[model samples]
Target: MYIILFNLLSWVTFFVFLFVLYLLILWMWGNMTAKVPFVGVPSKVLHEIEKALDINDDSVVYDLGCGDGKVLFYLYKKNPKATYIGIENSSFPTILAKTRNWWHKKFNTSKIEIIKKDFFEVDLSNATHIFTYLYPSLMDDLLPKLDKELKSGTKLVSASFHFTTKKEIKEIDLKRGRYQLTNKIYVYEF
Candidate 1:
């Protein structure tokens, strides 16, 4: 009985290890393909984002490349009347975002819609507010799309990277004491 139990435990451990390894590989592949790793907007930056935009019941907010949907969830919590949408291309992060949304729906009256699709393919015309934390090149590529799709008076709040082609109306520098952080939060109006 002891030997059988030990064998069963060993098999369980082996399967668990394999499953973890598979998940790790999937996460790496998703990140590589998406070109952006799963990085959540920091709480401090979220606060800055909150201050940057004016969200209301009529607002439709979109978070492009919203990994794990933390930004959308945070914004939804602050203004439950607004509709929040999270677009993520990576599978792992999309799954995580969906799971988080499901868990969050238990307590909240409104739900954040997390879609596992490329941001470029999704329509931005409906978005009254947009948030992102992407690299410089991606931001440059996204500008044309934003220009074409986003309606006038729409607000965009970008964390870390800003669009080179356009000027931001407001730039908020995040600092810890006297030291300024390399990345800043930029707000632009379309």
Candidate 2:
């Protein structure tokens, strides 16, 4: 009798947890679609960007909607002098970035900062390059902001979706059919 009750309780808890996770996903999507929806950059894509963009020590890259901060981590490893900043609104990912950066700092490594705030509010005049994988709607909203804030030569690298309803010629299409990578990243220079 006791075993039966415990099993039922466990099943109930599991279902409840699933429902909670589902609700959280929707809530997060509503708040920060592609912008901060916890997407770490794909390894192949990251390498491709490094080669194409010629990521140097002087590049100041900001990954908008930087989830668990994998892109920033990759950038830090690639170029030590490159200042990497990630603007993430979610609490969990912000904490993750903070902890990871703290550990790296303790070991005397690259300077990676994760700001737990909305990217739309931050000043982007100093950003040499901006990396993002946000959804189309969010990107659309950010388009005007970028146009106003970012300088003429600033680079914008977008993953998965485009902001405006326009075709990009300088896009990198990788692993289209059988390969795992589904999103085609577009790079634009302003």
Candidate 3:
């Protein structure tokens, strides 16, 4: 019994070590390639995001750099009829998002897609709403792509960072809450 218990404990430790190593590598890769670390939108911010977006049955929402699909999943619950797409470049977060999406599909009839590709590479022509929680510089870099692809009157909601070139139609500041790590959410119309 003691021998079996020791073997189980050793296996657990080895798996734990592998998980940590995987995360470490992913972190480094994200920083080097995307120039942004993987950070999930806080629960408080999700509320603000939902309020910022005007999703409908015909709406096609895209969450750029969607880490673990948390934002898309939350929005999916709110607007089940709307089509949701998550674009994640990092492998670990893509895997996590896909796993969560698989589980979510089992219980609901929502349309959620997790694509493991750079957001820049994907065409944004069909998106009715776009959500991003990326760095300021990256947000600036994304403006040209957004301008080129998104059709007229498309809504772009950005958390924490705003595009310098585009003027935001609405901006919400959430400083009162305890979970308010990123205080501002900007909304723009293309």
Candidate 4:
């Protein structure tokens, strides 16, 4: 009986490690293909973003290149009446976000829609609020597209990057301890 129990424990540990390794590989590959690494915004920063946006009950929020649906789900939890849409190109993050949504539905009735497609391909005309954590180059490419597509009075909240065309309505400073972070939260209006 002792030997059998030990064997079972060993097998369980082995499988757990294997699963972790598989997930790591999947994440790396997805990032490589998407050209942007999956960097989840800190919970503190997310809260600041929520506060800065002042999301309302009727706001339609879209998170372009939303890795793991963190922002969308966070906002949804705060305001369930609002619509939150997440667009993710990478497969691993999309699958992870979808699974999280499925599990989240058990207690919360708010539904967060996750789209597995390139951010460029998704439509932004109907978005009342948009959020992103993209690089400078991507932001440059996206500026004209968003200006052309988004309706007037749309709010854009970007983390770690700024848009070239639109002037920032508000900029929030995110600092921790002695180090003042450079990834300031920028809010823009269209």
Q: Model 2, 32-95: lDDT tens per residue?
A: 7434356566777787766545567788889888877888888777788888999888766676
What is the Cα-based TM-score of model 2? 0.77
**Stretches > 4 Å off in candidate 2:** 1-36, 165-169, 176-182
lDDT of 3 by residue, 1-190 (tens): 9999999999999999999999879877876776788889888678889989979989999999998999999998888999999999998788889989998889988699999999999999999999999999999999999999999999999998998777899988877565556788999999
Model 1 lDDT per residue over 1-190, tens place: 9999999999999999998888788799987876778877767677788878878889999999999888888888789999999999888888889989998888887758999999999989999999988988999999999999999999999987888889999998876545534258899999
C-alpha displacement of 134 in model 4, angstroms? 0.8
lDDT string, candidate 4, 29-139, tens digits: 987876678888877787888987788988989999888998888898789999899999887888889999889888888658899998889889989999988887898
- Residue 80 C-alpha lDDT in model 1: 93
lDDT of 4 at 74: 84
Off by over 4 Å in 1: 1-16, 177-182
Worst 10 residues of 2 by lDDT: 30-39
How would you order the candidates by lDDT, starting with the best? Answer: 3, 1, 4, 2
- lDDT preference between candidates 2 and 4, better one: 4
Model 4 local distance difference test score: 0.86
Q: What's the residue-level lDDT of 131 in candidate 3?
A: 96
Report the Cα lDDT for candidate 2.
0.78
Candidate 4 weakest lDDT stretch, 10 residues: 174-183
**Model 3 stretches astray by more than 4 angstroms:** 1-20, 31-33, 177-180
